[model samples]
Target: MTSTPQERLRLVGREEATPAAMSWVMSLDDSDSPRDIIDALGLAPFVSGEHPHALSAELERVKPDAALCPEDARILRTSDDESTKTVLAAGEGWMLRVLRRTNGTAMLHVSAVTEELARTVIEVCSKDATVAEEADDTQVSMGFWHSGAHGFSRRERTIGAATWPEIEQNYSGDISAALGRLMALRAEDVSGRLLLLHGPPGTGKTSALRALAREWAQWCQVDCVLDPEVLFSNPGYLMEVAIGVDTYDDSKRKWRLLVLEDCDELIRGSAKESTGQGLSRLLNLTDGMLGQGRDVLVAITTNENLSRLHPAVVRPGRCLAQLEVGRLSPAEATAWLDRELGDRPKPAVEAGGMTLAELIEARDHPTRIQAAPADTTAVGSYL
Candidate 1:
């Protein structure tokens, strides 16, 4: 049966697609043209002999009925009898292309896509929306004497490798001390220490933060910032959603364990004066604002020396107790292996002086790893 625009859209929103439907649809704004879309999506130039057209032609040859439809306002379908059809529709200064397959699998493919994809398509297909929703979401954060920056949505919950027991086993003494401080945060008698974990690249700083996040998530909201660049593009918007910081109209549930990973990027000490502004604002949010009530727990990870951070960040009242997170100690290394390989230390016996992050990368997941039961309401919770 031929699919209408609504049917096609419904397929795009679904979780399954037929093999023939395993295709990509790209919609570009006025800021995006055919050439720009090609570059953005990493497609080869149409002019090159070994280019995009070659692939499309190959698709056509395999299915004689396959064809390309001309660009138009309404959804266009190709007249060719090929197994697949490339339909192009342009409107309100934007372009939309859908590759429709004859087989049942098209529905399956569209169904498996992410919400970001669905949202992007909807926005692009709507009248005159210019923002492209497919921009890279992986955020990188760095700070001087602080944790790194990370980009994350307020609504999404991220899973990580470490857990409470893992953190306790590795950094027992430090974790114990942190726990005391964290518990004290409830009283408002003592200010909480912003755990400033610093170490070498590939060190367990980020891993430790993830572990810390999982550990404290059960008790308080954990709002982590994994990217710093977002601050540069939209400082006001960034602050509105930044960890431990709330706006005039924020809800009570925003209290969190604010984890800022790789904060050194913002205050690396070599950049321009403007960089300090974000760091200053971040510090204020962590301590100055949240410090009064002690309702927030701030964890910042960095590779830079704490002594080098700007005064706005490292002052005594701001982040007094800085903890150094390095490669796992000898005891930590052995214990970690014991946890992963229960009775047998097969990999650990052979491996030497590797961080948990390194070991995780070296081994395949769902092997030494067992999947934890999915959290039902985890998406909206503090974790």
Candidate 2:
């Protein structure tokens, strides 16, 4: 009688459980043979329902390590026969041929091999990545998990207020800091914090916020909340973000960052001076009772100066820190212009020089690009 993988684990017992060694255990669904179990998972139509052969064809096409049984509602585990095939004699026994990895750890997969194991198989397989064994219910989800592991989708292009290049160039360093903050929060079992980016227009604040989302997508899930009015109008969006229902994916279980663009538009100046329910709603979203136990990073973009913003909105301990993005200096401006003009006689720019936006605007006209320093007495048109 051939012993099964589960029996083998029992035979190997304490020895195989060594800290230095680990093995893989894959579960395959068997409840529905010849039936594409992919449909039950609610996968996109492009991969399952839309195709003629559906999941079976796709699974066979991909040739995953193990597959669901076509006739019996069971899973079949396989490995190379070159190595020793272990036989563990136990109740409901089976056989397993170990697969050796470079790390020298023996890998084995076992399934319940019964009609009842269908749901478990799909669950084990449906997991996009290693699912957490256990997490606190009261804890706010980590931002790194949200942006990188949960929120991002390879199939869908991210829609943001800024262009891809604009986002990358702007958030290179700032994104790193934001992600670091998120990781720290996760390490300390704390929730995400809001990042307030306030300054004059064209300073790359908005672009940085978007880039932070994309960069953080490598580890944390990030979602951009455009137009607070639309989000709060539905009430569901507000509820979702408030209740931790607005998550990157099912595995993550909660949101990491609630990117609120142009929050100033929603909460700017004195509350008495503003004209919408959006502002108060945003305030409630950030500090309200529902916000507790949730990790939320609110990246706000505003043209208004920080000093002038309403005390309630910009107060310390509320926003954490106010990042100021002033206009680019002359050196930064020249570098930016050089990139845009590509050999059109680089302009002499200094710190507090023409902003990138201004350089682009000015570079469009050849005369302005070659214009003498305004202080140079302009070589007089008389010459």
Candidate 3:
């Protein structure tokens, strides 16, 4: 049994204290065992916050023979560099590893094991560097920041207020009209659970997500699931985000929207055959029955073809909306270009079937970008 001896006991401003308080303070006790001290103090055993299983609350294991609250778990990790070759060069404690989706890896220093500390460890390991520039606490946190230990971050993000209008101007006609109808939804009218936004690169997927954040700011807290790949593989990491045990600014918001950006394989065909249980977990989250009672909406963006998506994952009722952020039409592209060169013999340069992103780059360059870089295999592409 652990013990800390007390030679003397004193209380300041004891004038108003009760007789029992005075009696407790007056006892100059010797060392007491941890159990005796806990019993005397009437403190409950510490619990770990990383809820095992889906939402099970049972205390499965204890760390270090006792639990330490978050405030008590000292900060021992500083360097984010995950490479073992770098050598952290710091003292060791009960450390946990979290692999974030977008942000750098996270190292959690646990002084003692308890639920709060485990949750804190996941959070600390998952937290992205806070917004560098001054933006509102909510808006400033708008983007991906992964924790290496957690695989992906359950990081919250909502784009700044001023940027959405400017981003809207980038799209005209069909794309613009399609988005307008959805944005016009009344507070009580929203019925869908999953939003599938599929498109290729340079089609303004990131910007579109930002706009959605702005559109739903009044009712929803936008949370980014930074690492979709790891999200399926790691149950502990996935549960924290799925359960959303800890949410930001929940007082004002009625719902939370989770973003699984650039997740091609999670929704693609053969997902169950190849990707394992992650795809199933994702589909379950969007299910009408399975997703009941949870105030959350999932928005996923991918670069895969619309036809190739998994049939079960994209069933009619499961998805609230399926909007494609595809290449801009010729007329739309011309209109965008016309914004810069209004009515002065606009340079005609074969702009058919080009993405807005490609057009923007072409306008800036003296010549076109090199032929798609020879289609060489790069790291991190889904098969």
Best by lDDT: 3
Q: Please, what are the lDDT tens digits per residue for candidate 3 over residues 109-158? A: 23223445445544543333332345463363343535563144433333
Among these predicted structures, which one has the highest TM-score?
Answer: 3
Model 1: how far residue 280 lies from native, Å: 2.6
User: Each prediction's Cα lDDT score?
Assistant: 0.46, 0.44, 0.56
Per-residue lDDT of 28-115 in model 1, one digit per residue for the tens? 4444334334232332112221122211111111222322322234552222235534444433323334444554111101110234
Tens-place lDDT per residue, model 2, 1-383, is 87554542211111243344333232334333221222222222112222112111011111233322222222233223343222111112221112232222222222232423433433333333222334432222222111221122111122333334443333224543553453334323433355677766666665555545554543455655544556655565566555543445756564456666565655567644464566566666677765666655566677777766776677556674467666666555665677777877766775556544566566786454455554645666543
The TM-scores of all predictions, comma-separated, are 0.45, 0.45, 0.58
lDDT of 2 at 274: 64
- Candidate 2 Cα misplacement greater than 4 A, ranges: 1-156, 159-192, 244-255, 335-344, 348-352, 359-383
Who is ahead in lDDT, 1 or 2? 1
Ranking, lDDT, top scorer first: 3, 1, 2
Better of 1 and 3 by TM-score: 3
Tell me the spans in candidate 1 whose CA falls farther than 4 Å from its real position: 1-29, 32-153, 158-162, 172-193, 242-254, 269-276, 287-298, 335-354, 358-383
lDDT for 367 in candidate 3 is: 67
